[model samples]
Target: MTTILVPYHQDERLLDDEIPVSADITVRSQVPDGDAWQRMAGVCSATAAAVSPVVAAGGIPVVLSGDCMVAGGTVAGVQRAGVNPAVVWFDAHGDVHTLQTSTSGYLGGLSLRLLNGAHPDRYADAIGLRPVPAERTVLVDARDLDPAEVEYLAVSATRRIPVSEVSADTVPSGPLVLHIDVDVIDSGEVPGLRFPVPNGPSTDAVLAACGRLFATDRVVAFDVACPWSRTDDEGQRNIRTQLLSRLAALAHPG
Candidate 1:
């Protein structure tokens, strides 16, 4: 199948290189433009608009994003394509924070929680996105959640698994929108992240898991979020290089 690359490009003054692909869809904004929520309203709106038509036309979508909030747009696009979507969020933290609860005030930190509707509908409605019931979602490799996020997750219905268990057998069935934040892997292994967690899975382990998960034919679309700086040259240990290898594990896209 033809892969339509969706690059969520942003010049946050953090990246060390230009976006590698000529994006079929691009999400760009400056850091001072607005808060994280306002920024996502725009990013995901553009993402959904650009990606919805491509997905509806039977093309496979491969999202290369600057951060995890891209999940908002991916979910919206899959639904716009007339596909029922279950989500698999792979990250170092449980993107579950409310305006009242988050101390750091990082909006992207609320991605999965936002997807699950912890906040108002306005943010989601902006992109024509619907909330996925926590029951239909799985969160894997989130080893560094905040106190509020942890409390919410404790009561939430979303299934949580370790990075080691994120394989085909452990994931939910049916059409899926897979979200992989590169930080889900061990900080030591990847070495360059805006937010890195200790004791996360190895790149090799995650790749192996992704191989099986993708082979299931459940992934309709996927987003690979890279917070790793472009300048961090780690030879074979580069997050971008490792991400590309895992993305190739799928025999085909749904």
Candidate 2:
């Protein structure tokens, strides 16, 4: 059975408009307070508690919440269950910043870096999840990266498939954890993001790409980070619905 785990951020209200319609879904809210790092750890612990049983019985596909910080917790859950899953990170920015290098100091922006073993002080001992090696990680549709992040991407072995080159020959296969940051969609199409970039992939293109990738039967997890938008809530909800429907279609049949 595929278990969808929804870890809602405390500061962000749950988008209860479209969910709860699915009978197969199991929704668990994980609202955390206090420092960003601590809250992230709490979220991960909660996720592990919710998914351990399903994972122990063989393992199940998971659809996690949209806070990019939640990726750490998802990683912890998967790792604790003894699954060495490949990770496909779909985003505009690399999310590869350490505390020292990050200009914004936004914990969301640093989630990926924390997962990749960048900063020991900030995340190493706290998260209890080791970074998935660069070889096992593939980043797709990444264009708006910071300078230091670009440097890390250049040196690190993580395969990068730009939005333009997604059709290229180098895309990686699963057992994969597919992470989608909604900001990767152009601001015109997904105008609900806190940071809207001008040029990003179209919804159709992203779905098609994900469909092709998920057909590999290696995608055991899907995590989406679509931040709440004050302006276009309906539009963002529509996008999320479409994306989730596509993911459900691509998921392996029981």
Candidate 3:
């Protein structure tokens, strides 16, 4: 499998060497200040277009982005490639909201719900993305959620596995897109994150879960949301090394 590296800077200028390996494609945004929701929509659409060709050629996109919302575009790209891959969302936030449900009005927060086809969003429809069934979708380690988000999940069919229960077997079948929100790791253990939640899983635990998922040989795409790369990168380097090594392993046959 040919794996392409993509760094989604989300506007911050980070060099390739800052990460453990160089990226084949570097994605940066320069949208004028406007509606946050619209900006997010724009990113998803652009992400879909950028990776569509790679997906069509059967190359896996190893994307490093800033926010959980990027999954929408990742799903769109996979659809464009002729596969409706399931999404395994790993985030500290529920990310399953509607425009009405979100109190903070963070556009990316409702990414999962949006992808589930709850909207009349012109951009999503324009990108030709389909929704993943709740039964096929999994949201892992969302230790933090708003009241509305909690209420939505209570009645929703989406299967959720806490950090403690995440395992190779817990994830839905392969030909899957696995999204890892770096903030899902304990804030104390990790840094340079935009949002940090307490009492989350350890880095080792997250890596173990990822290992199990990758070992299944079912994962079709991977996303690591690293919104910011801080100057002090001792912690970041450790994470970068582990993730790159794991991705490299995925590319080569066992």
Candidate 4:
């Protein structure tokens, strides 16, 4: 397995130390002359390029990025490798908001939605990412959701479930792209989360759920999104390091 590190929160590059030190490949954004959408396209394109060949060679790629939006690139890369994969998205908040519904207009909030055929002009189409169908995309542990997100999920074909319910029987059929945002763990357990949601699952529980999915051996890509503030404290950095190591271990367990 190759670890691809993209140390950026959207277009803004994160601190150098924000990513795990085990990176085999580091993606650098090459923004073209255009608007915000075009810049994001360039970033996602860079990530996709790093992810494709690894999957084609039958190796699972573990992508570590600063935010969930990079997931579009992971999916695109898998598709480029000729595998049509379902998506299992695990996060604290529902990443299903569109530009119209989002009050803060945060692009990260629309990550999953864009993967399910939203805003093709700016996102999916820009990077040549074929959107996964709603039924094939599952959102896990979205405990903190906006009213608009809730409404969309209620009517949308996408399946929503808790972290404890993630297993082979519940997930979409065929190959999968597992996208886990570290914030899914209880905010109290993970320090410096930029968008903390209290009263979530424990770190152990989250790992256990991930273990179940990895055991299936049908996961094509493991994408980890660390949407947290940079920490100077050694204790906090240690916690983050431990968590990332555990996550990487899941994809290559002996």
Number of clashes recorded per candidate: 0, 1, 3, 0
For model 1, the superposed segments whose C-alpha errors exceed 4 Å read 1-25, 28-36, 230-239, 248-254
Task: Return the candidate ranking by TM-score, descending.
Answer: 4, 1, 2, 3
Model 3, residue 245: displacement in angstroms? Answer: 5.3
TM match of model 1 to true structure:
0.85
Q: How far is 228's C-alpha from truth in model 2 (Å)?
A: 2.9
Q: lDDT by residue for model 2 over 137-158, one digit each (tens)?
A: 7888778888998998899888
Q: Please give the distance, in angstroms, between residue 122's alpha carbon in candidate 2 and its true position after superposition.
A: 3.9
User: Over the full model, what C-alpha lDDT does candidate 1 score relative to the true structure?
Assistant: 0.71
In model 3, the runs with Cα more than 4 Å from the true position are: 1-21, 28-35, 167-169, 229-254
Best by lDDT: 4
Worst 10 residues of 3 by lDDT: 4-13
Superposed on all Cα atoms, the candidates' RMSDs to the truth, in angstroms, are 3.3, 3.2, 3.3, 0.9
**1 or 2, greater by lDDT:** 1
Deviation of model 1 at 221, angstroms:
0.4
lDDT of 3 by residue, 1-254 (tens): 44443444432335555555556666544443556555566666677776778778877777766566677778888888888788888888888878788788666676788778877464467446787888778999888988988887888888888866766677666588888877778887766666778898887787677767777777767877765455555766786567556645654447
TM-score of every candidate relative to the true structure: 0.85, 0.82, 0.82, 0.98
Report residue 123 deviation for candidate 4 (angstroms).
0.2
